[model samples]
Target: MHRVIAKLAGLTLLMLSALPSRAEEARQFRLSVPAEVAESGLMDYLLPRFALKTSRRAELVGGGAADAVISADPQAGTAVMARAGTVYALRLTGENAAARRFADWLSSDVGQRTIAAFEPEQGAPFAAARQQQAGPAPALDGDPALGREVALRHCARCHRTHDDDRSSGIGSTPSFPALRALPDWADRFTAFYVLNPHPAFLRVEGISPPFDPTRPPAIIPVELTLEEAEALMAYAASVAPADLGAEIVHQ
Candidate 1:
């Protein structure tokens, strides 16, 4: 009888311990930011406000490039903030349908309000463009060569194109060592590029075009039409490494 009683007590204690952990998990919400934005220290300014507005316990995690927020017990509420573009509802709970509805609403008016509040100087064209869905689209001609050409012409200025160099490697200029490597690279590049164009990258080391923050954001002036961009994206999707390909899909 004593042994059975001890076992029952142990089970009770175990259940008690699990309750808090399960509650914590249910309340937790994670926010992930790309590496470039984190480097710029944008999260330092943005996160506190979000925590305060949502009345949630927030912790910032991950130091290198990516920034993430683990919010515990987020209050059911909505708030808005603006920067490069308007961000509506700083705390979005993936599990809550109401949070999603609020996000959609904020994506329109409140998003505009937030943008106007933070970056008043940015032009309308850039603002509107940023809000649009910028993910990879369907291909134009289904031609890998054409995609390579588009990448070389538009992206080669900042990224390495060949397989030889010091940055990526000896001949690794930013273009594909294999098409499978593209999805994650594309995801990282797109996230950073859409958020903000790096002015410092305009001029290669020893090259001209003095870095200027005041200049309008550099638009990649798509030489390829939407269809071509899609085709290039498909080509990129085909050859990236397996793990990177999964990350790209997640991003």
Candidate 2:
């Protein structure tokens, strides 16, 4: 067990030495791969590219003490990626930031393209599993009326709730309509409580942990029940998106 850890650590240092520029800031994690993958030199081919793009490094290791794993079948943890049929895919064991970034890159179009491009001396390149057509997401469950009330009491201080709500909310911050216009509006609304500015002063009862006493909120805390937070999302979803036209090209 100690020998395996030492081997991975030594390899990590060697890899870091090759990239002196990012070595200091690099986040290193272990990724356990099947023997086939290791023998194929996929990590040797993929890791350098991933590290160059993300500045995070993975030290290839065997089973145990790994932050992530490459598997043909995942029994647990987040399934990151896999190829069609015979051996494929990387899986995460936890919410490691570096691991997530690696997963993101692996799932990205570039990542898929890179995977398809890799050709071992003796075998065919791995291909992505065929994805099924996804249907529209269901509308979030909550009371829009109550959500509006919550928004007016809390969010309205920073965001314009309606087109006519110019008198309220800070000018620098975006309006609800404008935010709803964004591509990731749903993600933004649903996870806003964890996003910046909100975390400092906002709390969702039974969901968010209590604020640290040593670093108390800058302003009087604004607390909400989980129901209120869900309702706020419902209201935001109901808002009409502002018309943000085509991108301006600088030719």
Best by lDDT: 2
Q: Under the 3 Å rule for N, CA and C atoms, how many clashes does model 1 have? A: 28
Scanning candidate 2 in windows of ten residues, the lowest lDDT window is: 129-138
Query: Which lDDT tens digits does candidate 2 get at residues 53-79?
Result: 888899887768778887756434333
lDDT of 1 by residue, 31-88 (tens): 5444443454545544454445443333444523212221211222232321232222
* Reference-based lDDT, each prediction: 0.40, 0.71
Q: Which residue ranges in model 2 land beyond 4 Å of their true spot?
A: 1-139
Best by TM-score: 2
